[model samples]
Target: MTEAAELPPAPQQAEAVFGDRFPEAVRYGELLADAGVRRGLIGPREVPRLWERHLLNCAVLSEAVPEGVSVCDVGSGAGLPGIPLALVRPDLRITLLEPLLRRTNFLEEVVELLGLDHVMVVRGRAEEVLGKLPPVHVVTARAVAPLDRLAGWGVPLLRPYGEMLALKGDTAEEELKGARAALSKLGVVESSVFHVGEGVVDPPSTVVRVEVGESPGGVRFAAKRAKAARTGRARRRR
Candidate 1:
């Protein structure tokens, strides 16, 4: 078998970004470089730039998140923004949602090893877990899908007046523009494109922010949540 790729040192900016949790961040980087690549969760080529492209890139997303809120990271394959965000912002409760069991196992291990009690791992698609999981104040994603389709999965999991922070690349604005109608249908009241990690990272990470009003996930999802709540109450009484 070939040798495992080495994890690069964390950039100086990482300490400032992750604050007191810098050591945990380094461990997470190590895990991604070794186990993450071996497990095929991330490519070996990504190891050299793991700290910059993955950890730091995702940790900076904490700037856009609110002071204290619940966040759901949809399609959280290797816990990009979820784990990093948890490291930086312990004030926020995070749920890393991944459909694949292998990925979920990785996430649960990371959460446990890193002592990220504020973070939880759930194995299921966003749509499938809609009623089972409580709606969150924010949903974060990275390289998951196109803006329109990602919104379909992420938006419905949000609570009223919550927002989705998607980490996109140069195509952020273009995708936001193209997804206008779909966002509207998903109860997205406002949407825009912005950048985070300004001087910390080279070009900065582009983000597509989609905000929803009272009825998140639209009319159908509202009905589903209501029914789920009723079912839970009946089960408790039984």
Candidate 2:
């Protein structure tokens, strides 16, 4: 396993990862890396990990996103998978949904700095924002939430037959077990897990793809909101 201390700085490695062909992607990564450094979002020693572990890990989602499709990235802190995907596939329209004011501000600045016209940022929680937006062909997340909860949040915004691409670590099996009940309740029937970057230095990761069906109605929405609000309040109090 690559220690966080041994990782390359985000800017240098991101440039190497994107190469010359994708100028915009490279610029976006550079800007985000700089911002991360300024905000102390990641430790200096962890720079290399940001590239191999964070950026490249997120970029792998590109293979699963179909061509000329719309994607929504929930809880898109610093626009990891979404920005990288948008950079690679200009054809795919990406909406980054981030509730935190600070992160959204940073993402908007990064988008402008990179001149990414294909992306948009939404400032609200997924549960509140998913209903208002058009159904997207794909929904993606990285370390945002657990499998079942993420599916519940994602399914409502997904077009029928649309898929959820969730990035997970080695504990994927345990998470899947815990999420089974929640998955069934959300109408996500077929779920499969794929291992990616097996030979890489970092611990292997998995992509759990869940097929979304119709969303639960208004009552369910309200209940979810109430629970989320209570959880947030608790966290704040703590």
Using lDDT as the measure, which candidate wins?
Answer: 1
lDDT of 1 by residue, 170-232 (tens): 888889999999898888999988889998987788888999998665547545655897899
Task: State each candidate's clash count.
Answer: 0, 4
lDDT of 2 by residue, 25-108 (tens): 655555555666566544555464566767777776776778999999988987877887777678889999999888888889
lDDT of 2: 0.73
Off by over 4 Å in 1: 1-3, 217-238
Clashing pairs in 1: none
Query: How high a TM-score does candidate 2 get?
Result: 0.79
User: In model 2, what is the error at residue 164, expressed in angstroms?
Assistant: 0.9
- Superpose all Cα atoms of candidate 2 onto the true structure and report the RMSD in Å to 1 decimal: 5.4
